[model samples]
Structures are given as structure tokens and as C-alpha cells.
Target: MERKNLVIVGGGSTYTLGIIMSLIEEKENFPLQNLTFYDTDADRQEKIAKATEILLSEHYPELESFSYTTDKAAAFADIDAAFVQIRTGGLAMRELDEQIPLQHGVVGQETCGAGGMAYGLRSIKDMIDLVNDIRYYSRDAWILNYTNPAAIVGLALKREFPDDLRILNICDMPIAIMKSYADLLEKDVWELVPEYFGLNHFGWFSKLLDKAGNDLTDEIKDKIINGDFLPTDKEIANDESWIQTFRQARQMLIDFPEFLPNTYLQYYLYPDDLAKKESPDNTRARQVINGREKRVHEHCDQIIQQGTAKDIDVEADIHGVYMIRAAASLLFNLKETFVVMVENQGVISNLPADALVEVPALLTNHGPKAFSVGEIPVFYKGLIENQHAYERLVVEAYYENSYNKLLQALTLNRTIVSAPKAKAILDDLIEANKDYWPALK
Candidate 1:
């Protein structure tokens, strides 16, 4: 077993511990010669870095080495792989991203609608720089990016680093759904396989099978139509709001009983209902801030003060461990099938061949090659194409810094169809994101 060197780029993120804990637990599968945490914010990264130190020392002290640094050159040096899940503006910017749109009676989600667009605009630049740093220091290092607004960020990476095949953009939502499906069926997730298609956060599961290859789509669909929401995967279910989001899939299935819909689709399909359901004064950001954000930081403080994580309750992310799973696949050539975003090419006949889409792909040492989805039905085809346009234009808007393109992207969003409303929203977003987004004029 050849140990590898890996770095977590956004090591300060609240989500960092879950991944680090996962790596420690799965060291047998993906042994590491060196584990490094890299973040620009010195204060923010220190807490996570301290807690990670406790975790490593308490468990895998025999491991070669572990360190956290703010220097890109030092962190990226000699790394075989880099797991990138950067929240560019952190949670504070996320609050603005979600709050601004809801103020205007629209669905305000971190990774959907106007909120996702704002996040995309802010994220594109950092993603580009991160890729460049990784390539510069570790040219062949696999940049497994699970960055938000994945469709747009991934597309930008595809365009900006066209020849960098090692950059694989992936999302965990599909696998989370699969874990939920496995829970519903009372089986281990490994025993089931799902056939899914569409864009990130905007996809559907068309087929599912057991180890014996038993068809299970209709069974899951029947459960969903009857108001059976998937049991949240163990890792994410800890968040009550996330559990609620998981349950909303029931309504989605009732409306589109032909296939299982991503929980995020609720934002687009029922923007009015979603708006009414949310509390603008305290949105998901507030929920996270008051919940996971507060708890994790406090936990890290406790671990640091106590100088040991032996007593801290660290829940393993059963399904949210997309990075670890993908790394293992690449490291060992496991040929694991996962839902990842990739250049559409010929995967979806109707969508632009150059478009980046979220479809099932097999992860190998080289990267993911998306499975062909053929042509989709008219209803989904139209919605997907329109969303694809939004993603592409947002990437262009970031690159071109064109206000017109920014507004165009907002106008095409299913949650904000009117040009006037889109303009109004864009202006407000520009005001809120003035510090983060590019100057669009």
C-alpha cells in the first residue's frame, strides 16, 4: 500500500472536520503519507487545524506527518491529490446570498436560484486560482472539487483548464439520495446501484437495482408518491433542516411521479410555496449559523481546550464522504460509479456537447467519464437547457464581467422569470455582494 500525500484547500470550513474524521477512519483504505490543511484565513483555519491535530494524534499518531499552513506553495508542495470544497466568501457571504433573494419573495437557497447564481459569481475566480496553484505545485494532482454552484464552477474549470483532465468536479447530493434510498429499502448502500441523469442539484434517478440486479425504481417511486420521504443519510440527517429538505422529496414525487427528483428541485418547481415556507428574517443560513456552525466551532474549542478529541462525538459522514470515496477510486482504480459533473460531450444528445452536466460516471485513476444519457423527455429537457443557459452565462459573466450577462442569467432563472424583477434582484445582489463579486458593468 503506497501512502499518498493530500491537502484540503479550504481547511477552515465548518465542513472540514467531517471530512478529516472520515479520512482518519478510512485510513486503512486510503492511507496518507502526509495530510495538510491549507486555508487563507489564519484565525479560521487554526481552530479546525487544532482540532484536526487532536484527532490525528489521538488516533493515527503513527501516520508520517500532519500540518496546517496558509502558504499555498508549502501546502501544495508534493501533494498527490487535493480535496477542494472552498466556500469562497464563507458563511457570512452565504447569509447575504440566501437573504437577499428571499427579501424579494423568491426561493433563497445556498446552491439554487438567485442565491446559487450569486455564489457562482463569487466562486469562479477562487476555483480558477486554486486549480492553478495545484497544477503549479503538483501538476498531476487530482483536484476533486465539490465546490458549490458546481455546475457553473465546474463549467468554468472545464473552460479555464480545458486540458487538465485530473480536475474532477463532483457533488454528494446524488449519493446522499442513494443512501436515503438504501435506508428506505433496509439495505446497505453498497447493495444498491442507481442510474441517474441531469445537472448538479437538478437531476433525477431513472433506475435503481439491487446486488441481484432487481429493478427498484418503481418501488422507490411508489413510496415517494405515497408521501414517503427518504430517511436522511446518517451523516446529513443530523441537521434537522436537512432532514426536512430530504422529506420534501415526497411532494416532488407527487408532482413528478415518473421519476425521483432532487430535493433542490422544490425551489424551482414551487418557488412561491418555498418562499412562503421560509423565514426571511432567519433563513437556512441562520439555521446553519445557529446550528451546525455554532456547534462545530464550540466543539473544536472544546477539543482544543481539552487537548483531545477522544471524548468529542464525531459522527461519520456515511454518504457525504464523496471526496474520500472518489480518492479511493482514483488511487486504486476501483472503477466506482458516482454522480459527478463533467463536460456533456455526447452524454446528453440534446444539451450542448460542451456543457458541463451532472450525470453518472465511473471514477478511475484518470478521472470520470460520464455515462451516456441519450435524449431526455421534453419537460425535463426544456427545464435543464434553460438552467444550463443560466450556468453558462454566469460563468461568462464572471469572465467577461458584463452586467448585461449577469442580468440575463438572473432573468432566465425559473424562480425569477421577469426581466424587471431579475434586474431589481441583480442590483440588490450586486449591492450585497459588492465585496466578493467582480465589478459587473
Candidate 2:
């Protein structure tokens, strides 16, 4: 039971409080010698840091030391792991990421199609710098990156940090879906084992098994197709857009019943429908800003005013739980199986060896060892190949600062197949993200 030091990059995020609460709850298993919050925004991090200080004192007072800072050297110093969830330009950029595409009559999701491309490009430079900073201070620290548009960011990190294997890119959508599946089957989430494949936010679950190893894929698919599928988490289900996302997942299954599609696939599979449903005036970013963002900050204020979180409803969210659990698996050598993003390297026999793919892998002390997916069918292979090309082009576009490469990537994207429309959206995105993205040639 060796205690470890941890640093949470982007500690100003709405997720920071929940993650800190999770650390307190799992203090026994994933004991921490120190905890640090590192963020660029001092005001934003201060609220969470002050509230966390009060909560930790009230709950886990035995913790040795805790602090928050903007100093990279102080934050990353002597840390065994880093939970990285940075937003390069924050939610304002995200609002544009969603809105600009819709103005072009295209899907405007945070992590799909043209919007994901925009977000991915913005994330690359920051992620690269963040990783370099972490290595400079804590060379051996495990960097658990759960950044949005993980598909592109994952590939960019792989290309930039080829020899550095300490980085692990992950997304919680699959876990969230599995929680819904478990709820439908009347079982706890951990009791089920799922076999899935493809890129992050663009994957499919080929099989799901109960603890007894009973095949539950078809059963869950049947339920999803027949009934109103929604997230099991009450907090998520409350969001209207999330509800639509789950409902659209049901529609995808009815149309392509071969494998269970990721909820995000709805954005790619039915861009026109999604675009029609999306209101340009009120995008997902707006909803989050008005909803969770407001609530969490207010709640943190209340906790700080009260000087105790004992009365405040402090529940560790799925994202926080997943991150802490995954980090623990790596630190303690738990060998737990979790779906994570890793280099293809023949994991998908038909896909290129260099492509970054998301698959279930065993989390050992060294990092994730991905499971072999063998060769996929022609239909899936075609879709994945196209998507992978789009992802690769985004990375290349960033590195080479080539506008044409980005246009090609957006055109190849399923959401906006027309070259003309892709160019229009790319131009607007370029204007919107000029401050963050590299100057394109």
C-alpha cells in the first residue's frame, strides 16, 4: 500500500471537484501522499482548490499535503501520475466548434465530424506542451489523458512522443454505455465484460458478457432497438441532448444491426438529422455552461461558504471514478481490463499498424496491452479506414500547417462529404480558432 503523488492538470475544470472527491473516497486503495491541482486560470482553480481543501479537511484529514498552483514545476514535481483533461481554448471555443458547423448545415458535436477536427487541432499543441512539461518534472509519471476528441489527440501524441509510452489516452463513453447496458440487465456495471473495437467515440461493441461469460450483446441490442435507450446515470439522462444521443444510438442499431454503435456515431451516421435537431443559438456547450457548469460552481461556493462538504452532495461521477480506477490499476498492477485508446499495431488486423484505435486492454504497471481484434468486415473496415485517414490528416495538417490537408480531412469525414462545404466550414473554423490553431499555409 505505497502512497503515490498525483497532479490533476486542468484543475479548473468542472470535473475537478468530483475527481478530488473520488480520491478521498478511494484513499485506502489508491492512497495519495500528495495532491496538486494545476491549471492556467488562477481564479477558476482557486474556487475548486479552496472547496477541495475544506472537503478534504472535513473528510480525509489524514492526507499529508494538498495544494493547487499554476506553476508547472511545482505542480508536476515528484508526481507518480497526472490526470490531464485540458481544454486549450475552454468552452467558448467549444461553442464555436458546435455552432460553426451547424451554420453550414452540418453536425456540430464536440467530438465528432468537423467540430472534433477543430477541437483536435486546438488540443495538439497544448497536449504536446503539457506532456513535455510533465516529463521535464516527473519523467516517469503516468499521464492519463482523457481529453476530448481523443481520437485525433491520441494519434498526435503517438506521432510526437513515439518513444514515450507513459501516456494513456482514454474516453468514458463506452463505460457510460456499459453502465446503461448493466442497468438494463439488472446487474452492476462491473459484473459485465464487453468486447469492443474501433476508434474513440467511433467504435462498436461486438460482444458483451456477464460475469458467467454469457453472451449479452444481442440481448442488449434487442433492448436498445425495441425500447427508449437512455443513460442509466440520472444526471446524464436529465440532459435533453444526451437523451437524443441515446435515442439516436437506438436508431443506428435499427438501421445497422450488425454491431452496437457508439452513441457518438449518430453524429456521423445522421449528420443531417442531428443538424436539424440542433439549435444554433443553443449548442451543447451553451447547455453545459448553463447547466452543469453553473450548478457545480455555485455548489462549490456553497461548500466554501459552509467550510464543509459533509452536507453538500459530493458524489464521485463516472468520469472521476473511471480515471481514478484506471490510474490505480496502473499503479498497483491490478491488471484490470478497460477500453482505452492505443496504437493499432495489428490490433485490428486489417487497419494500418500506425493507426490509433480504441480497444479493451489490460492495465498493467507498464500501461495498456491492447487485445487483438483480428480482421474486421468490409463495411466496418471501410468506415474505419476513412475515419483514420481523416484523423491522420488532422495531425499532418497541424504539423505541416497545410490548409489543403485539413480541407481533405473534413471532406473525407462522413458528416460533410462535399469538398465545397468542408472548405466553407474549415474557413469559418480557421477564423474561429485562429488564436489557438497554428497559422495554416
lDDT of each: 0.85, 0.91
lDDT of 1 at 298: 93
Per-residue alpha-carbon lDDT of candidate 1 for residues 277-339, written as tens digits (9 for 90 to 100) = 887788898888888878889989999999988678876685436679788898788898888
List, residue by residue over 330-407, the lDDT tens digit for candidate 2.
999999999999998899999999988999999999889988999999999999999999999999999999999999
How high is the lDDT of residue 161 in model 2? Answer: 96
Worst 10 residues of 2 by lDDT: 232-241
Best by TM-score: 2
Q: Global CA lDDT of candidate 1, please? A: 0.85
Model 2's alpha-carbon lDDT is 0.91
Model 2 misplaced regions, further than 4 Å: none
Off by over 4 Å in 1: none
